[model samples]
Target: MSNFLSGISITLSAIALAVSGWTAYQLSQLNLLIDQQQNTITEQQNTNTQQQDKITQLTQKIEQNKALISSDTTQQLNSVSTTSKAQNNVIQPGQFVRQGFDNKIKIELQSVKRIQNPDSEEKNVVVVQMRIRRIVPKGKVDAISLNQSRGRNPETSEVYRTIQNKSTSFTYINDLPQDSWGNAYFWLKVPEGINVIDIVIPETAIFEAVPISS
Candidate 1:
């Protein structure tokens, strides 16, 4: 009876030891699984942060582009407004139209006269008289002529060339002092009955609605 009781006690002790070892292994596995889960969650959080940063940067770029477009549109509108205002200031005849840079020269329309052609009574010569004065230079000045001048019939839009030989009287000048003005004539041959004309000069704006004196 005593031997049997000792065998039973030893078997009970072995079973308890095996059970404890198995419990420790299960705890270790649980710890490993928890660590792996935490690592996966951390990686996911990092990826989410990077994606959010990219979205923020794109938003900033879009706003910057909008601002640039608005500024360009406003500048274009202001340019158009300034051009319209300048066009409203119409330059008239007899008023001095300045040429070149500041104080270079100013030309004035003195008079417009019509004379019957000596060769043909039906034809007429239109004379456009101009005066030029120097403002910047003090002494000697260059000779000025109306060789390239033209006359335009506003009603018909017909253009007439200046007569070279007949205009040599007052068109060409050699002794025009600075600050003093001289006469430059432009003669155009046209058919009879046409009165008012437009004077067109090279490098100058057209003189419109100039009445011809008979």
Candidate 2:
């Protein structure tokens, strides 16, 4: 009976040893899988950071391009405006017609204004301001006539005469100063809606397409 008990004890010890070895192997495999998973997660985070940097750089470039396009558009608009103004001869600031022997007298358009009509209560008077200048001391500027026969509306063929009164500065034949630059104001009664007219600067030239201002 003692021999049988010793055999049974030895068999139980062998089974316990095999179970412990199997448990240890399973734990080692689980640890290896965890380490590989951690490496994969770290790589994914690094890729995400690089993609964010690229997105920020692209956004900065887009803003810079927008500003450049806006500046170019403004410059193009200004260029078009200046060219159109010159081509139409509207509000010519430096245009002048010269006459007299060797072109000594220069008649420049200073200002064109709309004034109230003296005879009527409406604003139907056109005021033409001319700047007459003597370029050479030897030449002469003939007496300019501001009469209905001299001023004509080419569109309507209507005549416009100067306002000649005791207080008005209407004269002939150098009765006024023939000095340097002199201001000559020509006031004429125009139609209620007439905005443009032509004037003959006697012995010089006929100024055409003169614009009227408000």
Clash count for each candidate, listed in order shown: 0, 0
Candidate 2: clashing pairs of residues: none
| Candidate 2 lDDT, 1-214, residue by residue in tens | 8889888887777888888888888888899899999989989889998898899999999989999999999899999987775555445677645453245567777766677877779997777777666655543434454443245787877777766641124444344444766766667666667667776655666777676666
Error (Å) of candidate 1 at residue 42 is: 99
What TM-score does each of the candidates earn?
0.46, 0.49
- Model 1 agreement with the true structure over 88-197: per-residue lDDT tens digits: 33234645354532345567777777787777775588777777766564444444556767888999989888886756343222344455876667788866777777
Candidate 2 yields a Cα-based lDDT of 0.67
Which candidate comes out best when scored by lDDT?
A: 1
Q: Whole-model Cα lDDT per candidate?
A: 0.71, 0.67
